[model samples]
Target: MTTRPGRGRPKASDGADRRTALVDAARRLFAERGFAATSVRAVAREAGVDAALVSHYFGDKQGLLVATMALPVDPAARIREVLDGGRDGLGERLVRTFTETWDPHEDVIAALLRTAMTGDPEQAPALQLARAVLVVGVREQLQGPDADGRAALVAAQVVGLAVTRYVARLPHVRDLTPGDLARVYGPAVQALVDGN
Candidate 1:
């Protein structure tokens, strides 16, 4: 008799399916309960999987959130496009590019912002997911061994501007024209990227 390949114990097809179900359920719940209030146990119940499975699939809530919101774009490729375009005046370009890309679709970002502000543990997934994608994408662009810190700082500035201008809708800042924004916000973002 012949046996199919087995790395260890039998692999379950349901693992992937279950993870998808959990993420979908978590997304809806996070939207509804505002993240902090939602629990892995609750998500597992909703997904019809044992609570252990949630841990097994996600390693924890943050992992699940990161996986769930996995950027709608191929972040690594896009960041490469930006960095490879030459670094001069990249601040304005990045601000313009990111805002333009994220602005057209307000619903998704708004939902994420709302959940995050509520300070729910559930929202950790979305916040961390966004951060993880950015850090991973921009890491390759840094120079020297301390590149990680520079990359992180840049990511923070990029994300902060996004949140302030778009998510929080800070009044005066929000009303500024694109040209105005490039003048005011560009330097800050640039400093982060320039690491000085």
Candidate 2:
């Protein structure tokens, strides 16, 4: 016997609808409570969907953040790309990759940096996320007793460069082309990486 379709809910549309709802809820929560404060359960509750769906859709909170922020580049992937080859010129590669990734998205990067630096309770999570990306990426490539300190130094250098060049629009830093910046800044970052 053939079964007829019943008009109750559309099965095919449920996935798309739920995905949309999840993204919308995540966007709202991330903006309101910041990345670290907004939990998967909270986003799910706001979307009226199961918390598991958030994982299914975004893999994790970081993934959700990338989506919510509409970031032009994926930090983890870019970090891996920069660190892919041997550790010979990691600093240069990292600096070059960072500038290339952020150049086109200066406005977005500026907004994120502002939010992270504001010291607002709601925005603290944003700062943490930034720290995690930079520190963790550098730490993974380093080997020694002072890995953490070195990682922090690397993070500072990168963040300082971003703030001065992109956000603050410093005359000298702002004027350098990507290659010039990489050539000038790469050794500084390399020193940090080498813990020298």
Candidate 3:
């Protein structure tokens, strides 16, 4: 009798599956141990893959952080889109873009927000990832004095809006449609962006 192909390990075609496994593993570890505490080797072990595979797929821990968050849209691309039309309506554009991007992923966002609110040092990576996406875009687009402060203010406004609407599930804010939200909240964001 001829020996058959061995079933020792998964075939190379399972690359996509492996990537998914890594992301799932990262999410779990990040949630359980926080980003700072979770090592690449640990993530790889959790995924049952070689550490090199994590590097090959995610480049590093930060890359894995992005993947684990599963953001609905690419933050940089969305930022560029919001900034493309100039700063005339930047606040409204930002509000609309952010709410729209997150509306479909409320569950994911809420979970992340809860994890971040835990005040665990391990959660710093997740918080940093959130800040990088939200604040970096604002800082990049803003001009004039105290750009950093302005960006922080703008980030606070948008993040607060998300917390109320999504995480807190505030009935009044949650009831408003996206367009209504843009109309209601845009001016506040605009003021911050305009440095008024």
Candidate 4:
């Protein structure tokens, strides 16, 4: 016969709206607390849902971090597309996509990047997580003994440009259009991608 319920976890209210809420909550917490300091349970609590739902929806904290990242497109996929068209203008493609995608969203990207790269003792963990999430794919695509080094070199070019243009707002770089920036910055990135 039917018996009354004892202590059990509540049914997860899973759906698009719930996922969006969790993402929104996660974005806030991640930005406010930094990725290393934020937890899955904290995101669930912020979203007003059971902790299990965070795992159910996002797999884990890293998964949640992926979902909440500010980049509007997959940087890896964009790189793949640039690679697909061959190496002739590869640098331009890479730089163009980066400039176009990151220009309008510079403020948000700048804050996240600044926090991660500040070199403050308190910011080290965030730096590690940022390095993992942001450019791991570039490492894989390089696909060689020194893939990580190559990818890191590529990242340095892009991140340096982003910081000088967007965060620091330097005179010449800030004055340059995306096309102009791509023309200037693309070849260096291509060199790294080519292992040159």
Candidate 3: C-alpha RMSD after superposition? 7.0
CA shift of 42, model 1, Å: 20
- TM-scores, all candidates, are 0.53, 0.61, 0.61, 0.52
Which model is ahead, 1 or 3, in terms of TM-score? 3
Error of 4 at 26 (Å): 16
lDDT of 2 at 66: 61
Q: Could you tell me the lDDT of residue 123 within candidate 1? A: 48
Where model 4 places Cα greater than 4 Å from the true spot, the runs are 1-88, 118-130, 143-145
Prediction 2 global C-alpha lDDT: 0.75
lDDT of 3 by residue, 1-196 (tens): 2222334555565544768888888877776666677899999888777778777888877778777777665656776688777778888888888788878877566657766776454644656765777687678878899999999998899789988987778997888888888898999999988888
lDDT of each: 0.68, 0.75, 0.77, 0.69
Candidate 3 colliding pairs: none
Candidate RMSDs in Å, in order, are 10.3, 9.2, 7.0, 9.1
The best candidate by lDDT is 3
| Lowest summed lDDT window (length 10), candidate 1 | 1-10
Our tally of clashes for model 3 stands at 0
Candidate that beats the other on lDDT, 2 or 4, i.e. the better one: 2
